[model samples]
Target: MSDRAEAAVRVIEGSLRKRGRLRDSHITLAHGSGGKAMRDLIEDVFVGSFDNPALAALEDQAVVALSELASHGDRLAFTTDTFVVNPLFFPGGDIGTLAVAGTVNDLAVSGAKPLFLSCGIVMEEGLPVEALRRVVASMKRTAEQAGVYIVTGDTKVVERGAADKLFINTAGIGVVPEGISISARNARPGDAVIVSGYLGDHGTAILVARNELALETQIASDCQPLNGLVETMLRACPDLHCLRDATRGGVATVLNEFAQSSGVTIRVREAALPLRQEVKGACEILGLDPLYLANEGKLVAVVPAEAAQRVLAAMRAHPAGEHAAVIGEVTGEQAGVVVLQTVFGGERIIDMLVGEQLPRIC
Candidate 1:
């Protein structure tokens, strides 16, 4: 871990130890009444856990100095995402970790350094407070690991049955360094396409967690913050063309987007695609395509062919990108299309899904 990330983790651990414990065992309607109950909930759960100067002020909005923001980069990148996974607690992560990592990855894939986040949680009145606490703790740990702060947030409670247990929304801000212009439109012929790690683990893990399929495989969700990995890649290949997190629509969706935006054909080799054994088995049993499965931590980067080796080396050195691979390349033929070359030497068009295959997996 980097020095900044290590320091953030230390701060989070120290704060958790200092704040004894949350007293409420279960959430009630009173906690959302904007009274003493609400105050206690916020102070004990959210504020106490995510201790930071901006959040400590207890203001409606976080105040940040322009000088502080400008020091990191030339432009700001902002993104928001909502988490409503069917099973709040999955095999490897819960809603809270997903919320933090999801939003942070969004900014990171935009070639930005994530700095701050805003969390908005909706709790079911009868939900157990312990569950909420567990989720909050995960968020704290993830934010620390990502070297970002949750500077502001809000909470709301709804009657039982109104909400599935808990729903979390996160908005994040990041700084994009000067001369770093990464976007789908930047993809060009002769550029190398790379995937940070194994795909479909997250989407498959969610399905197994829900017991929708009787197959029992140990596929855990690949939910993680990618800013650190992205930073490493940028340092090695500053002229990267495009970087995108394979989230809701997975790598196939991202490739299609790049193809459309850049008006180039992306040809991927099936033999080069990375996949975990368990995830592959699960997908086969469920009649799912790993290419279309959602991935919370993985990313697809487009970089000049000359820099591909260095960029791939940088990614493999990072913990989050140990399984990175050079899966494809950009081509001028058949613009706005993604072609997957099978292991058997045959090729087929990989188009975007016309309808939702797996909803709420992220």
Candidate 2:
């Protein structure tokens, strides 16, 4: 190895002067070589950070017990996601929290109640052990809030120069409730469009945080799990037409997908849409539309008009849905297209995001 690579290796070993605490240091290539360096990195950083029964098992795969198979029948819902945001730590959450929330939201949006999660982490050798610990701990907390268990996990280390500081992949499995059927294709004209809470906050917050730039007002990500809110809404609006979480492609993309799948048009009222003052200002300053920004925790629900008020009330009762609102209505014309009704009574097409506005944002 060159002197720079040698220096990087020393920097990692130097972090372990004492036990339990990793002194601040950068990662190096040797740590990922699958030798003593790799073992040291795993034991020092990953194992130290995510010290749990499942992870402590230290097996190649996590073995989970599924009690629901006996009680709930064989129906199951499974979803997986990988997070590689540029900045590991953002305003409201780290990659770990995003991993948990993203997986849980996937199941919730699919009309399932999440039960267990399997975590897989790829870490760079030179990363500070303390940082890994913080992220793992955050993931554990998020899983707890979603009422799920981290039943299994795996950790791998790559050479410092080969990968970013960290990346996390999570797969979740849940039980799909009976009588609760939801799909993007289920939207229908005349159905009211309801959003669980404010939009664009999570996306804009990530942009600001990743740029190492701050806006006039301090903005934080709205990253959270929506299982509880979703459960409540399902109880009140069992006839709900469809459900979708606005993640990478934002609300516009979500709407576009619903339109195409359901063979309907979505007309969102510009005024009815909830935009946080700070989020709006940030979007304006950054020349980014809040509509296309990513959201980790929020979701959109299309329901029959009669059940709108009841569903909205159920959403608002949950802490995550405090800002819930009815933002739009489904239309018959222009199937597979989303149209935004402006404050001035004119309309504009809300299309799918062409290219990524913020790459590696979740």
Candidate 1 lDDT, tens digit per residue, 1-362? Answer: 99999999978865664465556788999998887678678888888899999988888999999799999999999999999998989988999999999999999988899999999989998899989989999999999999999999989999999998999999999999998899999999999999999999899989989888788788899999999999999999989998999988889999999999999999999999999988888888888899999998899999999999999999999999999999999999977999999999999999986699788897
- What candidate 2 gets wrong by more than 4 Å, as runs, is 1-56, 65-67, 70-74, 212-214
Pairs with backbone N, CA or C atoms under 3 Å apart (clashes), candidate 1: none
The local lDDT score (0 to 100) that residue 272 gets in candidate 1 is: 97
lDDT against the true structure, per candidate, is 0.92, 0.83
Q: Per-prediction count of colliding residue pairs? A: 0, 4
TM-score of 1: 0.93
The best candidate by lDDT is 1
Cα distance off (Å), candidate 1, residue 275: 0.8
RMSD of each: 8.1, 6.2
Which residues of candidate 1, in runs, are more than 4 Å off? 1-22
Deviation in angstroms for 351 in model 1? 0.8
- Candidates' TM-scores? 0.93, 0.87
